[model samples]
Target: MISGVASESSSQLLPWQQPIWQDLVRRQQQSGLPHALMFTGIAGIGKHELSLRVAHWLLCQNSSGQADGLTESCGHCHSCQLWQAGSHPDFMVCQPEDNSRQIRIDSIRKVNEFLAQTPQISRCQVVVIRPVEVMNTNAANALLKTLEEPAGESFLLLEAERFGSVLPTIRSRCQRIQLLAPSAEQAQQWLQASGVSPDQASQALRYNPQAPLQAQLWLEHNLGEQQQQWLDLFGQWTQGRAPLDKVVAAYTKMELDDVIHWYAGVLADALKLTLSVAEDQLLHGGWLAQLLNACGDGATLNKTKLITLQRNVQEIQGGLLSGAAHHNKQLLNESLLLQWRALLQ
Candidate 1:
């Protein structure tokens, strides 16, 4: 039952999305827009925002009749005003309930009912469902009905982090557009423009890779110093200079999923170093050199061991994301730290 109208901020497009935006605008202008569209990409690459922007354009009162060749919404129109206030009658957003992973059948049923009605103000009705991969089978099946027999002038905009994870039936019915992460240079420029310092921006990109929005979030949270401290502790633990409990204590303060992601990045860098990967190619290259110095050298960092540790971390991450329950968090962190310590031993 989580349903709401998109805010004005959601209508803004990211710079990297310009090409896709232009193409969609052309399709929309030519009356070639699909009844159902699914945007697929890694999280934080602006899939949801792009979808909402299209939704906003579709619902704008001035969009259809504009002779000025404008493809964007007029923000001051009555429809845009309603949308900005989160009370738009013709638009809806469906997502997982708070603190829940799955969007149940109940929500999709509401979506069906919402789309069943005529457009109250705008010329069309639009519904946005994000991370559609999390919809349970019943929920997805319920959505399939709308996709198969779409109501007049109604558009369903869906987003998923992984296209392969979406139901095959859902995929076949929707026009799929895959968004790509921005290049490192483009990401750093965006972060810097957003007020992150150059060095901080670069470091965040290293930690987050091609995901600029996520890198910006990393900077906003001021996690760079803490991340470095965690890396140093990891280096000490691997060298047997710091106790395993000490390292685990520091890491447990963060969410287990985040801790594991950081650990995986470290392992990835170590594996790269073991294979003589150039420094520029490493995700956490800044810390790897110091880590190798602390531990001995590349000779001590075994490639096979790093791969095995990465697999273990990935398994834990997958379980955590899948909502697996009954995990003993502290013990799990301890076990992972012990595995890291063994790399040096």
Candidate 2:
């Protein structure tokens, strides 16, 4: 659905899909093409999908190898069909396994072997590596030799979250194609086109369309429901009679890492209340006056909220919360809730 051939059932292509596809089509249409291309960008930005689309285009038998005689393997031909099914003997896609972020040398060796042999079908052998920077030393070494020549017609599509972390030798041999997220407006539009409500689409843009699903789920599930629970607890805490320990325990059970985020949501409501008698509606404008009153009636809450955001970003950058998610991912679930309470206080 991205830049390459789109079928009737293909998923809706995001805003960032067209540029890379068009570039490749143009170059291949013109002359001898880049065999090894490094598609570099942020994680979850659809780089993997982009790589597959290019592979499909390259191996499509229906394609008459472009206008250039230099182009090979027609897109609609038999070789292309095999590539589509991922049954093509010469094509390979490599990546790190679950629980490990680094690509082992063994994986690289396998890729090398796949490329070393002559292409059984198409003239070119396509090897795609996702998150190329995940290659460990031995893996890098194993791939380095193959990358140098990569055989004419051998196309390597390597995707990495960031470019700087990859080996210079590995990068030097390949052409780099940078992929970026579409504009915020574009992301919202894409989601709307996909049938999501405008409100949900707008909410998902908070993080990045690269991860719109994450933003959508967070807002719809966690923030929408759990956030209300938190607001109730916040109210009880402000009442003076509620034991701070019990309230703290409830907060400890809540899932929130960015304490500043939670605070700001409430803090904004407090400000809105003061400026215009918007009435009690803090935290979705519910009990706004109560929240403003709870904050002790001042602009100080805004300043505190901003400071909290700054501090949270710093600590997160330092991996201060790394231990929170260590051991089991669910293990961190508890730790995250506990830490959120402590951090906010």
lDDT of 1 by residue, 1-345 (tens): 466656898789999999999999887776568899999888767998898899889889988833454688889899999999989999889988867767888989999999999999999999999778878889989988899999888999999886887889999999999899988788888889888789888788877778888887787787778887887887787777888778878887887777877877888787777778898898765567776675564436556776898898888776655433346778988988877666763
TM of each candidate vs. truth: 0.90, 0.66
C-alpha displacement of 270 in model 1, angstroms?
A: 1.5
lDDT of every model, 2 decimals? 0.82, 0.61
Residue 314 displacement (Å), model 1: 2.0
* Residue 162, model 2, lDDT: 61
lDDT of 2 at 271: 48
Clashes of each: 0, 20
Q: For residues 43-94, what per-residue lDDT tens digits would candidate 2 score against the true structure?
A: 5566777777677566655554567432323445677666545477666778
Model 1's C-alpha root-mean-square deviation from the true structure amounts to: 2.6
Best by the lDDT measure: 1
Where does model 1 exceed 4 Å of error?
65-70, 296-299, 321-326
